[model samples]
Target: MMEMFDFRTNNSNGSVKRRLLWVEMESVFGDLPPSGISGSSHNSFTVEKSAITPQECENAVSLTHVGRAGEAQMVDVSPKESTKRIAIASCNVILGKKVFDLVLANQMAKGDVLSVAKIAGISGAKHTSTLIPLCHNITLSHVRVDLHLNPKNYSVDIEGEAASTGKTGVEMEAMTAVTIAGLTVYDMCKAASKDIQITNVRLESKTGGKSGQWSREE
Candidate 1:
């Protein structure tokens, strides 16, 4: 299921105005499709349409455009304070034997495929702002990646972990790490198989922040 925030407040005449903010998942499943493991369908959490304050709406609006003007506007971490943050991301790639063989042998032309890609994934997690159009630049303390080969399905699975101490969670970092790693896998294996596909990238869990802990039941 997913958890989201909706900000709302009363207008000058006391009528309510609502804004759909942050559509994020509470938890995600890494298993392949046909098991209802996909990330698209999930539950959501919402606040009442008249519960928000004017200041909160303004803050949210301003936060959305922090880095756009090429200004180094320091994000106010005071209101959010500190909290332990973590996110898990996973993705799968289906390919032929040659692609798997190259991965297994570490003979891809792009150099040490897994090792280099792992580094890239970690770096990407730290620098998600550069890749994603509008993401906060966060200080991530930990990133770990695990790769698995599933011969039965002729696919590769990537799992990533991201942790930090901040207001916003590291879900974006985890998701970015997994995505970059999956893309790297595709790049290295494309020479061997043109039918390669990356699928099911999503956040598996998160801890800390105001929302508390969340994990997929399935």
Candidate 2:
């Protein structure tokens, strides 16, 4: 699975055509966003906004639903080749002053909230397949979590990085780790503050594979 290849083809005119092919096999289900949109007073509701509205999302959710029992419809990954992959995801939670103070002081009832959540985030990265259905289980090279506090609003930024050398990137794993870690933080510190707001979970950067590289625009 770790083999990397380089190839060159010859044309009828005696000219060489060089290209690189990278194998990638990722489940459409794993690509779907787990959260659904809900109408808000500030935003208008529209059928176009539903998960099934867009063709890609519809394909993502419905393609696996074959009518017959034990039916199988595998996605085509034959054209794809293997390459190293990595992904990073991040999110933040805004905490109230009282709770933030308690957390900084390590006075929360739950005890060492940040440390526990950091560990949880790393573990979550390793177990992303279990938490998210349809995602393939691949060995991860590294998982890192960072927590930072915004002194002004008592907010905490949770960042997770997941790395692997495989057919697919680890974006979902990093995202899941950040999300679960944020939830764990809230759970641990809720006694001091129940008004925490989790916000802006997103992919930060990714490298390797056929797609090349991507990084969040500043």
Q: Considering every candidate listed, which one attains the maximal TM-score?
A: 2
Q: Which residue runs does candidate 1 get wrong by more than 4 Å? A: 1-78
Off by over 4 Å in 2: 1-79
Q: Provide the global lDDT of candidate 1 against the true structure.
A: 0.73
lDDT of 2 at 153: 81
- 10 residues in a row with least lDDT, candidate 1: 18-27
lDDT of 2 by residue, 1-218 (tens): 13222222244332321121111111322232222335432321112212333467546635442433334643344466767888889999888888888889989888998899899899888888898666778789889998887788888889998888877768988998999899889999888767889999999998887778999974
What is the Å distance of residue 67 in model 1 from its true position? 16
Which pairs of residues collide in candidate 1? Answer: none
**What's model 2's overall lDDT?**
0.74
Model 1 over residues 1-218: C-alpha lDDT tens digits? Answer: 23233223334432222222221111122222332445746433454444667687677745434555344464555678688898888898887777777778778877777777787788778888788765677788999987788887778888999999887778989989989988888887787778999999988888899779988754
Candidate lDDT scores, in order, read: 0.73, 0.74
lDDT for 171 in candidate 2 is: 90
| TM-score of each model, in listed order | 0.64, 0.65
